[model samples]
Target chain A: MNDEIVLFDYWRSSASYRVRIALESLGLPYRRISVDLLAGEQRAPEHRARNPQGLVPALMIDGQTLTQSLAIIEYLSETRPQARFLPADALGRQRVRTLSCAIAMEIHAVCNTGVINHVLEITGGGEEVRVGWMKKFIGDGLAAVEALLDNPATGTFCHGQAPTMADFCLVPQVYNAERWGVDIADLSRVRRIAETCRALPAFQAARPETVKPA
Target chain B: MNDEIVLFDYWRSSASYRVRIALESLGLPYRRISVDLLAGEQRAPEHRARNPQGLVPALMIDGQTLTQSLAIIEYLSETRPQARFLPADALGRQRVRTLSCAIAMEIHAVCNTGVINHVLEITGGGEEVRVGWMKKFIGDGLAAVEALLDNPATGTFCHGQAPTMADFCLVPQVYNAERWGVDIADLSRVRRIAETCRALPAFQAARPETVKPA
Candidate 1:
């Protein structure tokens, strides 16, 4: 139990879901501490002290606290080399990192809860406009991901038969898209990969619904 | 030279600046190929062929194309282990990645060129509003980064005395923040790191003004 890991997360956070998937995939044992974003729990003093940014998915590992989903996922990969989440080669690793960043940095950030709220506040746009923006960006991003996955270079997962960091990122983004009523069926390549990932117990267990708050 | 690296970039892109700094720091032989973002050169079929995302800072390495500034930097670090852009240990590596993602995902994307344009179009808000949003997000992000740097763990750079991937991200972001007329000096930690980094020739060569099309 001394090796215990704790994840401070919000169930619906795509970022949190990404880290959850990575932890499950690595089969690491972790305790979950839910921070309710909708209720402003993340902004509370205690949570802010834990993470100065007032963000969820902060991980406590090896007696140190870390924030940011990509950071946490990369840390897990580094500490647990036997369950490497990135490719061993330089180019192969870059491809995986590129895909992950495309979603994490480009797609997810654009549709984030805060951004959506800001857009609504500024434009007086209703849910429709907000959802429209979300759909447009997510669809475009997923198309890019699909293009990469469709490459002959791709196999069972994002990079190859084995799961890499890209797979962890893809599943959560797909889940978020579904919430916005964005149809991903046309993205055959992405759909196939998500289905394959869903069949895995690790990915299954990490679904947002599986978390405590849900 | 056979090992020449050609960077497809734009002068004002924060993402592009990141790769330039990494390449310059590694002391690698590389040439800049400007893709004018303001002129829509990035959307041309020729440029899109290199990066389907039609974004700047695509690295052509040994004939393969690498997109995403973070990905390109990671590739440089992996391929040239001797340069040591990341730390040798797993924990230290995670910290670096976490810091890098904080800026890339949180700050850079929020104030991205495309998003800023979109906000301007929708809100009918002029440069003041747009620049206001940019300063708020970038300033808040730098403050978080400053807190991270305040830890005893920090050295001359973001992580330690040697510049790492986090420094690559920080320099470009600070550049953008300054361009918007944000007073970075208020965030003393970030200012100090930026000052230390600016002293390096690598960072100087990577400045937006140094890129073609300036």
Candidate 2:
């Protein structure tokens, strides 16, 4: 049985970056296929066959293909205990999931390329509007995340002392935040968490600059 | 041990709608607290204290407060197997999560009230633009979901014959598609699955009209 893991991803995509961090963290060797978001390769027939959603970071593992970065991370967490993507306790898991979804669902989803492009088309707005949109949502969203982290459970990472799925999400989102120049100086907890995650070799290797196409 | 469940939600919020369906499906009795999104009550200090994200559908259960609708649903799915919100197998769970995230993260998040309102504000467009935005994203998103349903794994529901978290997400999204008048007549699989789920009392009871405050 051929069980080689393949990740179809875009380097700059927050979702794709998340799964890369997961795979790198888990020490899972996988093939990387860039679905160039720049050229709209994700909408190609070949990519569509890989993912009906026509989104990147579709992970082929365990003889099955998985879409949705969070779901892929959760699958990795469930199957591989080497790195715990989610916490063991229900409440802890819920907290991590909540934090991850805050970024994925609330921030990243809205800032998605398809979405922002539509926003540009509808509003007749240009690059400036795109930057503004990113800053507003990312800034406000991270502020809320900072508030959510105001808990005794929050350790060095988004959850406990060890990193979890929440940190994986946070790093990519923070990258987007920095990319769009969304100020996080006020978001102390988010800044601190991103710094901690970025220092890790797993997150560093998955960086957009690290995998940016030549 | 205060196990009494409480759900802080707005009637029209899609995320809240997903949680409502989950509770109804689980036959889990919960106290409903309305955080009026229209009046901007969700931004109130009290609600923010409960949910730092200031989002609707915050669930209080098993002596802890949980936010993020899908996380709440997943928590319920994990805690209570009587309803089986997710599949038992890993691959099955991945598919269900992917489908659920498609709507929850991809469609619903982008079409959120905050995002839409911001669009309106920035575009200087009126209600017509809002309608256009809703139709465009909801229509395209559902179409992708329809393509995803083409899989053999899709039975009467989004996954197999039994309803999982995907169905919970689908019901609300379909309702939004209908509410926004995004035509789904061409989406046979989605329409059929929605019809099948709608026929079930759990989904019916969670309809926005069913729980809408007078």
Highest DockQ model number: 2
Which candidate leads the pack in lDDT? Answer: 2
Where does model 2 sit among the CAPRI classes? high
* DockQ measured for candidate 2: 0.86
Across A1-214, the per-residue lDDT of candidate 1 in tens digits comes to 3568999998889999999989888888899999999998988989978887888888988888888888788888877866789888888888999989988988998888877887888788897879888888898888877766756668899898898889999999989889898878889989988889989999989998787562
At residue A103, candidate 1 shows an lDDT of 89
| Tens digits of lDDT, candidate 2, A1-214 | 4799999999899999999999999889999998989899999999999998899989888888889999999988888879788988988898999999999999999989999899889878799998999999999898889999999999999999999999999999988888899889888888998998999999999999999989
Per-residue CA lDDT of model 1 for B1-214, tens digit only, reads 3567888988889899888888888888888888878888987989877887778888888779889999888888887866788998888888888889889988998788777887888788997889888877888788888777777768888898799999999988888888888777778888889889998999999887776462
Candidate 1 CAPRI assessment class: medium
Tell how far residue A200 is off in model 2, in angstroms.
1.2
